[model samples]
Target chain A: MKAAKIVFGLLAVTFLMAPLVTILPLAFTSSDLLSYPIRSFSLRWFEELMISDAWRMSIVNSLVIGAGATLLATVLGTLVSLGLRRSFAFSGILKSALLLPMVVPAVILGVGMQITFIQLGLVNTHVGVIIAHTVVALPFVIVSVSGSLAGIDMRVERAAMSLGANPLRVFGHVTLPLMLPGVLSGAVLAFATSLDEVVLTLFVAGPNQRTLARQMFSSIRENISPAIAAAAFVIIVGTVVVAGLVLLFRAAAQRQKPSTVTV
Target chain B: MTASMATSRASGRGSTTGRDGSMAASSARVAAMNGASAPFIALEQVEMMFGTHRVVDQLDLTITRGEFVSLLGPSGSGKTTILMLLAGFLQPTAGSICLGGKRIDHLPPHRRDMGVVFQNYALFPHMSVADNVAFPLRMRRVGREEIEQRVTRALDMVQLQHLRDRRPAMLSGGQQQRIALARALVFEPSVVLMDEPLGALDKQLREQMQLDIRDLHRRLGLTIVFVTHDQGEALTMSDRIAVFNRGRIEQIGSPTEIYDRPASRFVAEFIGETNLMAGKVTTTGPDGSLIRLDSGEDMAASAADWPAAGNEALLSVRPENVTVQPVGTARRTERVNIMQAKVADSVYQGDHLRLHLDCGQRRMIARLDRQVADYAVGTQVDVVFQADNCRVIPT
Candidate 1:
């Protein structure tokens, strides 16, 4: 039975990792044909990605849009989480509405946003793409932040207040610091979500505002190049690094949790 | 707020002068001084309603400066609600609260200048012990040097100065509680409100902390409003206890007054173990009143609030007040009531024996000293109590 379980686990891992295994090595292939068996490995494709104007511009755009969307989403989502903590009549409905983007089809959101952006005269601009990405990234931020908020004891905030800290000072000194790990993880998730978003960028962005994910998508359709593989490699490594930092933050948070006494 | 500070400081000085005397005498002096002045904290007709449910209904309470008052009750009895109201965490639906004769009902919790220690300690996890104690001073924008000096002194007061660099998670429950106490007091606020602050400790630790808190209250001349469901804790630590039942105070008085002469049936049952006999007042006299029990026994009891003859009454007698003697060993004397009883059961406690006696159909408990001769099951005995030891409460 144990052997069968081990076999099944290995099969699952292989199935999940097969696509990355097949595609990543192509990024290091010397030939541009994208064949599996490479005669030699070269850094030419990586250098081309950095030197090409279209690819370089797309990389910069992705970073700019990702940072902007993460900042906007993290702030708004944390506020929404705090406000929703003390629930009112319509709070549940509002929360579900905010989370709608996570389940709604990305194509539908893209088509809807394209028309709205044009009406707002935000089309073909970096702001429009960032705003579009933020809408999709908000659910991840809210869910992460709300989880952290729930672990906190409300009495800690009250203790700060009783110790002569006003509302704003209590937030700054107590509540914000306690929930920092959650906020950091949520920001990472928001950035990763913005980095990979393609359909919304395709609908809302023009050629000048093309993001990395959009460029990769168009490259696959127009031409199969190793440089696209290099870009994918960079994104995958970047995501792993961000995820590692989040894990570190969570571990530190767990270690420092205050002892809760029960009577 | 400033006026309240002045009054508290004056009481602090007065207490310091009497520090060399006995604790009881010093506290009495403080109480006398406080009684001669206006109340430090006063709640006048305060009502707190939660939607359709009224948590605190038209309640009034007053705490004299330097007095430690405990709001004692069962859960849902509005004792904690009153504490929160006093701390400015919950606004009253009606009426007002005054500190040193200044109305403070509209002030926010921080502006009220009150320190509160929560049941769970509620220490900040991210802060060191010294920083936690220094939080109030930092919030007041005290200079860094003064903050350090005060934090050191506060930690010293709790005898936790060695643990100043450690986080709250690393401390034991008792140590964490001391940190919470130090943090609450470092600001030297006019009043300190504690909500079952030692409820999380074990029995021995809780008892020790109770003594420590009482000592602190006497030494610092602090006006404290404590809330606890534990009656023993209130009796041990409080100068005055307000026994609450269903959003109203059943009675409020000194611990001895509450225990020896409970104002109502609820207060009698809530405070400790007591034998309550349903009776009717048969005759009233200058010395005491005669009560005819429903079980066809007659007893004499002194009444704090005299009930007229032919009024319904309850006789409350603490078990320790009831003494058991071998049958016919002693004759009844004036102002003493005696009954022939059969010992149904006797449980040997550490320092005493709890005897359960049967007087006709009514059961009575007597706590006899361990040195007293044992009365086995079914042994005939006489149960005796003085009129002054039992109270006749009008029901």
Candidate 2:
């Protein structure tokens, strides 16, 4: 039975890893077109991804949009979580309404936002795309921040107040520091959401405002450029590095935590 | 939903004072005459409401300057609520709070300048002991050098100077409690409020800390308001205790006055172990009163405050005050109230032997010194109650 379970686990891992195996090696091929079985190894496609203005501009757009969306989502989500933490008559309903964007289908939201952006004359603007990304990214921030907020014992805040801290000072000194880990994780999630976003960008973005995901989608459909494989490899490696940094940062924070003393 | 909120608000300041506001004023006047020039902290007709529930109603308390007063009660008896109100965390629905002859009800928590030691310690996990103690001074914008000096002095006062660089979680429970105390005192606020600060420590540690805190109270001459449910802690640490029952101050006096001359039945029962007998006042006099017990025994007792004759009364006798003697040893006299009782159970405590007696329809416990002859269960005994030791309170 144990051997059968091991075989099942390996099969699951292989199924999930099949696409990466098929695509990763193609980026190293010498051929201009992304064809299967390797002809020869070359660094031409990676060089193309770096040197091409269009590709570089798309990467810059993705970064700009991701940072803007992340800032907007983290600030608003944290405020909403804190406000909802206090008991109020409508707090439960308000939380569900704020999370509605996550439940709605992305295609429907994209179409709706496209129409709204056109009427507002924001269809070609970075602001339009960033706002759209923030809407989808908000739920992740709220969920993460709310968990941390709930974990905090409110008596600590009361203790601060008793120790001569005003409300704003208490938030700046105590609440914010305690919730930093959750806020950082939420911001990273928001940035990732915006970087990988394609459907919403396709509907609302102009050629000058195209994100890296949108650029890759067009490359796959129109030309199957080997540069696309190189871009995908970069994205995969970048995500891993970002995630590893977050883990390392969290571990450092954990180490700074006070150890319980034995009598 | 609104109804529930209203209900909670009312219940939060829940209990009504049976004797009314005038009684509180009289008590405050009495406290003011206890050698203090003026009342340091005065709560006048304070009422707290959570929705429609009254958690604290028409409450008035007075604490003298440099005196350590403890609010003693069971859980949900509004002792903690009173502390929160004093700390400016909860606003009174009606009436005013004054500190040092100035009204402070309108001031915010930080502006009030009162320090509070919370039940759980509530030390910041991110800061070291010295940093935690320095926080209040930092908020007040004290000079950097002054902050360091004060923080060092406070840590030294708690004998925790070596651990100043350590975080609170790195300390034992007793050590953490001392850190909390030092942090609260480092700012030198006029009044300090403590809500069961020693409740989390072990018995030995709690006793040690109690003495430590009492020493601090004396050397610093600080006016402190302490809240606790433990009667023993209140008795040991408080110069005076305000015994609360259902959010109302049932009585407030010195520990001996509360133990030996309780103002009400609740005070007598709550403060210590007692044998209570239901009776009626048969006669009233300047020196004492006569009561007829429900079990058909007529007992003479002293009453500081007389209830009208024929009114229902409760006879309160401390277990230690009741004397258990051999059946024929007592020289029966009218001056001594005696009863024929059977020893239903005799418990051998370390310093004393406790005899649970069955006297016909009533039960009484007598705590006898260990030097007395041991009375086994089912032994016949004569219980003697001196008139001076028994108090008659209107029920």
Query: Which is the leading candidate under lDDT?
Result: 1
CAPRI rating of model 2: acceptable
User: Candidate 1 A-chain TM?
Assistant: 0.96
- All candidates: TM-score of chain A: 0.96, 0.93
Interface RMSD of each: 7.1, 5.6
Give one digit per residue, the lDDT tens place, for model 1 in B1-395.
12122323436435433333332333422463346667778899999999999999899888788788999999999999988988888999999999989999999999988889999999999888888898999999999898887787788888998888888999999999999999998888888999999999999999999998887777767788999999999998887899999999999988998998898899999999999899888888767788998877888888444677888999989999999888998577767989999999999999889999999888999999989988889999989999888888878
Clashes of each: 0, 20
- Give the lDDT of residue A224 in candidate 2: 90
What's model 1's TM-score? 0.94
**DockQ (CA atoms), all models:** 0.46, 0.38
DockQ-based class of model 1 = acceptable
Instruction: Please provide, for model 1 over A1-263, each residue's C-alpha lDDT reduced to its tens digit, 9 standing for 90 to 100.
Output: 99999999999999999999988988998898777788899988999899999999999999999999999999999999999988899999999999999999999999999999999999999999999999999999999999999999999999999889999999999999999999999999999999999999989999999999999999998889999889999999999999998899899888854423210
**What range of 10 consecutive residues in model 2 chain A has the weakest lDDT sum?**
A254-263
Candidates in order, TM-scores: namely 0.94, 0.91
For model 2, how does the per-residue alpha-carbon lDDT over A1-263 read when each residue is reduced to its tens digit?
99999999999999999998889888899997788778899989989877999899999998899999999999999998888888789889989999998889899999999999999998989999999999999998999889878867788898999888999999999999888887888888888888888999988889988888899999898899889999888888877776876676466546555434311
lDDT of 2 at B128: 83
Winning candidate number (DockQ): 1
Model 1 error, position B86 (Å): 1.0
Candidate 2: tens digits of C-alpha lDDT, residues B1-395: 11111211111011112112121111221332345456778999999888888889799988886667999999988999999999998999998999889999888888888889999999987788888999999999999898998887788788998987788778999999999998898888888899999999999999999998876665555678999999999999887899998879999988899999888988998999999999998987867778999988999887545778889998889999899888988865545788899999989899898999999989999999989988889999899989889888878
